[model samples]
Target: MSESAQAADPVAYIQHHLTNWSTSQPKSIADFNVLHLDVIIFSALLGGLLIFIAKKIGENLSLDNPSKLQSVAEMVVEFVNDQIKNVFPHPDKLIGPLALTVFVWVLAMNAMDLLPVDLLPSLWTGILGLFGADPSHVYLKVVPTTNLDTTLGLALCVFVLILAYNFKSKGPMGYLKMFLFHPFGKFFIPVNIVMTTIEELAKPLSLGLRLFGNLFAGELVFLLIALLTLGAGFSFGLFIWFPMQVLLDLAWLLFHLLVITLQAFIFMVLTIVYLGMADATADDH
Candidate 1:
């Protein structure tokens, strides 16, 4: 969208904001070719930030007197450990790091929501302008979780872990038996297969869709609030609209902080639980 178009139509502005900075504009149904460059970039940067912080904390280990950062990091590690212990009886060494990474990386992605919607977009526009590109064509969405692909990708990783743990705990024959008999019995092998496949697919779908749905809705709400507040200046009843926008936006921001944290924690816990379930044996039950 051009500057004049955005200025002339708020709807167009919102549409532009919702679009991702894709490698190319999708044209046909087979255009699985679209890549959300913005989502991948932000996700990678946030993941790198988490790794860097973890490395720094490991290097500065202390017993006598820990810095505030170390104290906070310890609390996070302890919290994740506790969660794993509660949910996963046979957590491997990787589970701790995986849980921590998921929690922190997701929390970082969610934190991007707290940024002003226009701030990054405006800055990106300016940067593109410097590079002699049409600023309007440069779409950038800072929140990775808001993109379905990002959430689904994370869920798929968890799904793979679940499969691995299942195979490890239950041998190949045992794993095959799980799908063939356990849920229904040998007589209902076909039904069991169908049901088991659905169940397996549902895990990742729910994990991904739940996170994506919540964050996407939150993002949309924030965008609506931005439109409300920003559009107030041009609305007919400016006096009333402006004040209401401020109150609502502020209220929503406070409420959304809780939402962002809870969503990240929920995603992490679910991943842990799913893996735990995979690792469970009939004897344990």
Candidate 2:
């Protein structure tokens, strides 16, 4: 948006910043066919970068004199392992690595929000403009966690893992039996089925919505703060608004560092807890 237009319509400016660079405009809120190319691209890129860093760290392991990067990587791994041990005490080889991956990947994705809101989007707009695209039509949202599809996709994977762990620990018949008679006797089978199903489904819904809501609200706050100085030119208003903008932005950035890290840790811990529940046998219950 041009300076004059952005100043004139702060709503439009915020909306433009929030819009995703998608394959096509969504028809409705429930439309699942639309592809958010920006979310997919940024998510994949972050995941690939994480894998590369991990591989390099693994290759250059030094016991006597470890690099700072290696030291930090080891600390993260050890922290995740300790968390897994607390919840998933069993010697399941998969849970440790899975928890670590989820924590690091989600942390990386959330960290993207730390970038200046207009940085990537503006850069992408300029690149597209060089290729004859209209600047006004270009849309890009860098933070993948702000996208519901991305958050839900991560939750759905955890949901699938929950089911798989249940099946592995309790056989197919045992799994069915638990759903049919859980938290109630066989006499109340219908109620038990309904309650158990809802309980299972709520796991993913809560997981996905919690992460998405927090990050989406954070993104909106950043946009609103940016709007504070939208129209402030070399006038006296610039002197007043500019300092407030910088102060607010810096304060938020500091707090959001905790938010992003906490969200990632919550996601990881909850995944471990859910899997722990799934691994419980009938006797344990």
Candidate 3:
């Protein structure tokens, strides 16, 4: 939209910032075919960046005198490993690395919220405009965790791991039996099946929604704060509102650093707990 138009409509400004740059226009709000390009791009970039950093750090390993980056990396690995040991004492070889990746990746994506809301999107819009694309049509949301598709995609991966662990711990027949005779035993098979199904489904649902809701709300607050200077011209309002806007943004940014880290930790821990539960045999249960 034109600057004046956006200034006149605060809702449009907020909506423009919230919308994701996608491969195609969605038919409805929940169109599966509508691929969110921004989320995929940012997520892949962040993952690749992490892998690159790890590889570089590994190649430069020096026990005699570790670099600051290497020291930080070791601390993160130890922290994640400690969390895994707490939940799954006999965790699989993959669990430690997986938990570390999830925590770091989620934390990195969540950290995108700390960026100025208009920075990347505005830069992207300018680049697209140079290529003859309409500036108004350019919507780039940097934080992947704020997108439901990204969060649910991560949750579904955990769900698959849960299923795999269950099948490995118990044979197929034993896993099936869990659905049939869980709480009340085979006497209440029907009720048991229904209850077990809901319980199983809720794991991924909760994981995805919890992460998405928190990040989305945090992003929304940043956007709302951005709106404070929306139409503030070179008048008395600009001086009054701009300082307040800066103060609010700084306060929220400090608090959100904790929120992002905690959210990542929560997700990683729950993943470990669920996988640990899946490893339990019928007798253990």
Q: Highest lDDT, which number?
A: 3
Ranking by TM-score: 3, 2, 1
What is the C-alpha lDDT profile of model 1 across 104-188, one tens digit per residue?
9999999999998889998999988998989678888999999888899899999999899889989888889989996899999
lDDT of 2 by residue, 84-201 (tens): 8788848788988899999999999999999999899889989988998977789999999999998889999999999998888888998999889898989999999999999999
Give each model a TM-score. Answer: 0.93, 0.96, 0.97
Off by over 4 Å in 2: 1-3, 281-285
Evaluate candidate 3 by giving its C-alpha RMSD to the native, one decimal.
1.4
207: Cα error in model 3, Å: 0.6
Clashing pairs in 2: none
Q: How many clashes does the backbone of model 1 have? A: 0
> Model 3: per-residue lDDT, tens digit, 1-285?
775688789898988888999988889857998999999999999999999999999999999999999999999999998998788847488898899999999999999999999999989988888999887788999999999999999999999999999999887998999999998998999999999999999999999999999999999999899999987789988999999999999999999999999999999999998988888632454
User: What lDDT, from 0 to 1, does candidate 3 have?
Assistant: 0.92
Question: After superposition, which runs of candidate 1 have C-alpha atoms over 4 Å from their true positions?
Answer: 27-31, 231-239
The number of clashing residue pairs in each candidate reads 0, 0, 0
Q: Using TM-score, give the best candidate's number.
A: 3
Q: Sorted by lDDT, highest first, which candidate order results? A: 3, 2, 1
In the order shown, the candidates' Cα RMSDs to the true structure are 2.1, 1.5, 1.4
Worst 10 residues of 2 by lDDT: 276-285
